[model samples]
Target: MKVKGVRLYGKDDIRLEEFELPEIKDDEILVKVMSDSICMSTWKMVKQGANHKRVPADVADHPVIIGHEFAGDIVKVGKKWQDQFKPGQKFAQQPAIPGQAESPGYSYTQCGGAATYCIFPNDIIEAGCLWTYEGDSYFESSVAEPMCCVICGYKTNYHTKDRYEHVMGTKKGGSIAILGGCGPMGLGAVSYALATDNKPAKVVVTDVDDAKLARANEVISVEEAKEKGVELIYINTADMKDPAEELKALSVDGKGFDDVFVYVPIKSVAELGNQILGYDGCMNLFAGPTDPNFSAEINLYDCHYNSTRILGSTGGSIDDMKEAINRAAKKEIKPSVMITHVGGINSIVDTTMNLPDIPGGKKLTYLQFDMPMTAIADLRNLADEDPFFNELADICDRHNGLWSAEAEQALFAHYGVK
Candidate 1:
């Protein structure tokens, strides 16, 4: 079958091309990708190309697909899985596989989320990476992968009560802080923090940018969190007299936070998280660093005496993805808040390449359509030019100017309901 997608040939060398796929083997499946949310990891991969560990050294000769956080419909199921799988069912995939650095959207040329169609190899099926999604919104399914990472970050964190007795997960009903929060993943972090079973008593989110903090709060409002018995706080440290001292003051009993998460890969943010830890505080470094030698200062004194510690993670596991998909389906966490821009397959290269400069959260793409990357916030401005935008703006307005299932349906409707 013929497929069209953006392939990475070298550093910053990506092209939209048409290629043919051989017939699927037994035990394999073919799917039609509908929605793919561009990730910062993709931007870093494009910049590093062959130098990336997951990318092949011969990437210039054999190109790979460009997206991993995506969702779609199954078009064909092999005979080996005919009874277990079928066409027209929605699906999501977890990219991490045991002992395989090369994963979907990083190493596989024919198995990627950036195309209208791609094959799900037998190995991926056997590994239990492919999940049948029962959700109505494909964008929500595409977003579940990142939300899974958010869930993993929370589950990876640990706290303790006594010597040699380590407790897993964040401290329940304790004070929490997210340093340099309010970015894309930071927003996801907040959503999970509020929605998790063991919700925090106090949640403080800090960012240098007031705009980001404002938007984050607007999407997941303080009042909304208050209804759940959590005192949500948003602070712009740029406006503080002494950021660290002032931030720590917001913790329980004006002591320190029980848990802290560093969302920005900056030395200051990491140090700030270190300074805000109360006794037995667990700081989770959620952001991935591009630099190989990136380092941050930590208080070893606090680690020795107060049990303050640090941990880092790259992505979520299969179980995390299942929980993420379930949470999104149950409306416990709105991954839609992470999305700010929408585009099509033709827009993936430019959008992924220039993502850091773009002022938004997740940039979602539709593979079957050809449209420029447009901000969800800017749809009302385009209402005069296209009736489609007018309908989208109205639909979004009804949902508080955020992306919704109705908005996704409206977009597909304007583009012939792809």
Candidate 2:
């Protein structure tokens, strides 16, 4: 079958092209990609290209597809797995396959969600990372992998009292803080921390932009947090002379936050997060820095006496992905809160190149490459010029300017999908 996708040739060289998809092997499965959410990691891969550690060595000779976080429908199943999986079933995958040096989106030449169709390798299929999803929208499932990473972060976080057995996942009924909490990944951490069963008594989210902070509050409201028995606070550090001190003051007894998530991969923010860790507090460096030798200072005295520890995690396991999928199905964590922009596959190159500059949450791309990347808030402006956009604006209004299953259906309907 002929398919269209964005292929990465080299650093700063990504192109949208049409090509023939070779026949899938007997052990492979064919999938029709429905929705793919642009991740910051994907942007990093775009910048690194051939030099990326996970990218295949032969990518320069044969270009590789560029997206990882995606959801789709099964078009064909291999004979061996015909009973296990069938055509017309919706699914999502945990792209980080264990024991495989190359991941699906970064290393696979013929497999990625950027294309209309892709083949699931035998390794991925056999590993059981491919998940059948029954969520309301494929967009929600597309972003589930990142949410899984967030869940994995919490699960992996632990406090070593005498040995490495004391597991404290965000310290239930304790105060927590998410530094740089306005970005999409930060917002995912916020929602997961607030909504999960192991709830925090207080959550202080900090960011420089008041607009982004306001959007965060709108999406995950203070009232919602209150309903979950959490005191949610959004703070703009730009307005403060001593942001670290201000954050520490919000903690109970003024000791410090029980859990501090350093979402920004900068030295200053990391130092600030270190400064505000309570006794036995765990600080998670959630963002991956571009620089290989990126270093941050930590108070060793506090680490020894205060018992504060620091950790970092990149992605999640297949188990974490299943947990995210189940949670999304139960409406426990709304992954769609991370989505702010919607586009088609054609916009992949432009969106990936300028992701950092684009001021919104996740940028979702549909396999049907027709619409340009459009912000939900901008739909109102577009409504005046076109009736199709007017209807989209209404849908946006209905969903509080956020993407939803209904909004996705409305969009496909507007595009005349049968």
Candidate 3:
């Protein structure tokens, strides 16, 4: 079989190529990718070029396959795998395969999911580590892996078995704010908050970009709060000289929001969210510093005196992915809303190289491999074949509507999507 995918061979360079499939070993199953989402991590890889940690040094000399967020079908089972596994099942899998040689404290593994076909060990199958969702499309199902990473991040920060368990105020009317709210992770926090059963008194989202803030409001349906008699404010954190003061101003009544979710890498939001936290307020850091060397200055005196708690989370865990999948299945949460662009695998390079120019923060873009033109006419057509796609397309359409179709086309064109 020929597998199609995006590969990086040098700095700031990615190519979509097809390759012959390798012989599958016993106890391994081969999956044909249904769809894959371009991610910030992949963006970082292309931006950094050859310096990315995840890009194997060996593959750096060759075209290394690069993608991790995706879902697919079990098309081929090895001789040993066939006895235990069946084909034609939907599965969302992790790409963190252990390398052949153990390096220092880390186990060596060659793993990735960007290719059209890849193999998974029987352990992953028997353990149910590969998620099986009956209702999710392959494209939408791929998001479960990303959701698992979010769950992992949630677990890292809070001690709760489930982060959704903590309802700030009422089941549907709690108070929350997301700082640097115009990014993907920020967008994820927003989705989680809205999808949670706990209601908020208000959900105030802020961003430096008026355009992005506008879109955030639409995607989350924050405006619907007005009809429901709930308070939701979409503000611009653009003018505030400092993140701390800016957030402090947002939290009226001398107490900050019941919950503050920081999406961008603004170090000050962490401190400020703590400073203005309500009596039992919880400020969560859904975003971290971009540079590993960066650290935020903390005033220990105030941090200890106030009952404020500051927490941070990253990538979802298996449990979190299950929860996210279930939530998505019920339409309680839709991850597709984050998708902003759609293109073929050939467009991956340009897309990652110029991500900022692309509109819609936390947008999910597709690299439709070998798909025909009739199926790829527009966002609406692109999403129609998939379940979660319509919701995601609706979110994109809402923002695309704010601008002229020509303008949206130009933006997509800049990323070589057209």
- Clash counts per candidate, in order, are 0, 0, 31
Q: Rank by TM-score, descending?
A: 1, 2, 3
RMSD of each: 1.1, 1.5, 7.3
- Expressed as tens digits, the lDDT of each residue in 1-418 for candidate 1 is 8888989998999889899887888888999999999989889999998988999999898899889988999999999988878899998899887667879999998888899899989888888899787987999988888999989888888876567687788888999898877887888888898889879999999888877888988899999999988999999988988887898899977889988999889988888899889988888888887777999889999999998899997798999999999998999998988999988899998998898999888999999989888898888677677767887878888877689998898888888955
lDDT of 3 by residue, 139-204 (tens): 455566565555454344321224335432222344677677656556665666655556455667
lDDT of 2 by residue, 311-415 (tens): 898799998888888888888887878888888887888999999999888899998747788898887666666678878878778877778888888887877
Number of the predicted model whose TM-score against the real structure is largest? 1
TM-score of 3: 0.75
Give the residue spans of candidate 1 off by over 4 A. Answer: none
Which candidate has the highest lDDT of all?
A: 1
Q: Is 2 or 3 the stronger prediction by lDDT? A: 2
- Pairs of residues at least 3 apart in sequence or in different chains that clash in candidate 2: none
lDDT of each: 0.88, 0.86, 0.57
Name the runs in model 3 displaced over 4 angstroms.
Answer: 47-51, 61-63, 79-84, 95-111, 121-128, 146-174, 197-199, 223-230, 239-254, 268-271, 362-418
For residue 98, what is the lDDT in candidate 2? 90
